[model samples]
Target: MSTLAPPVRRTLALTKANARLLVRNRTTFLYALVMPLVPMVIVFASGGASDAAGANAVTSVLLMAVLFPVFYNVLSQVVTRRDELVLKRLRTGEVTDREIALSIALPGVAIALAVAVVTVPVSLVAGLPLPSNPAVYLLGALVSSVVFAALAFWTAAWTRNAEAGQMTSVPVMVLAVAGTLVAAVPDRVAQVLEATPGGAMYELVRTGWYGAGGVGDAVEPLVVLAAWGVVAVSLARRSMRWEPRV
Candidate 1:
């Protein structure tokens, strides 16, 4: 019989356990599955427009598909785990902190990836054009996931518990949801939102989908995302708690 490496086995077990927990948790279920699906189905049923605007609309919906779960669901799980002493116990085991964090993040990441994959065909069927630059869109999606996951961890440091997670998560969620719709607002508002972390992600994916801008267009958003990542990582490293607060 073949034997798996110790690290691999541990990661698999942790991921599997977390995945099951996510599935069983109704809140995670709604965010990961039900919430994303509602918008997707709405977009699909609307039979997307046949223009650049239509394509942008599709892009926004797809971004939401990735954002909600990765942002909210992961935030809840991380804060809940920490408050319940799950992360503390895991830290005492052979598992590294990195492994534990990744395990906690795995379920939401899987859901985001699945939703993103389903978006392509759904957009096509809804009459949106295929991404003119697939690589750029894919890269944007990846960067967004990583940035949001880092932010989730950073936010969880102060979240206290799963119930408080909803309150703490509001600022970022509003930023993301508003960022996706900023174009519909006035130029001044759009410009302001564009400087936000979610705005950077929304612009990156939208620009990538339309292939409207040159390399210069991609550079700014990439820099914005990187900046957020750095800040979130630094803060999370400094303040994230493994033990429940008294």
Candidate 2:
């Protein structure tokens, strides 16, 4: 009476499900659209355009704002949804576990990439330059999005309810704000932040823009991120619950 979906078809369906949900949620749509732009607006108004010192901080803030949703918010929701039976339901159908997880993440990547494309023209119009080395920036975005999504999936496994996804992801938000302060605060603080998760994203992006050779400073954080990625993916496989509690 019924047929099974191919793995690729299953993956596409899940990815579509993820994107549609975000589109339908008015609050989420607003947050995704406006949040990333807020930091850049604030930085420019706060005099970030005045000097090189401010440039590092501005770059960090802008990227973090973009990353928060792509990484923390979306990934955390993926985790929570799994616990709530959304992922489990899909499994009873045609999707494999890998397909489900990858699908959950694909929407965020697409949205973030879209935002990057749109933001570029707007940013250049507003005085930001086209990055001389676009590869590193693109690489940084891809890496950060994937890494954080995995972390959120792991975090959601431990989270009790869907609401906790927001609370649990707070550390990420705080760090993002702190990266912005790198413009206003002392050098040591910003440098220290560069060693954290999204912290290195800021560092890597700045290096891409200016070619100042400072991206090396982010190597330590990059290693830490990769290590975290391994742990998160492993945890998701071993501990991820694919069925609702009976």
Error of 2 at 26 (Å): 1.3
Top candidate on TM-score is: 1
- Measured with C-alpha atoms, the lDDT of residue 125 in candidate 2 is 61
Candidate 2's displacement at residue 215, Å, is 7.4
> What's the lDDT for residue 221 in model 1?
86
TM per prediction: 0.89, 0.80
Q: How far out, in Å, is residue 194 in model 2? A: 1.7
Which candidate leads the pack in lDDT?
Answer: 1
Residue 177 lDDT in candidate 1:
70
Clashing pairs for model 1 are: none
> In model 1, what is the error at residue 79, expressed in angstroms?
1.8
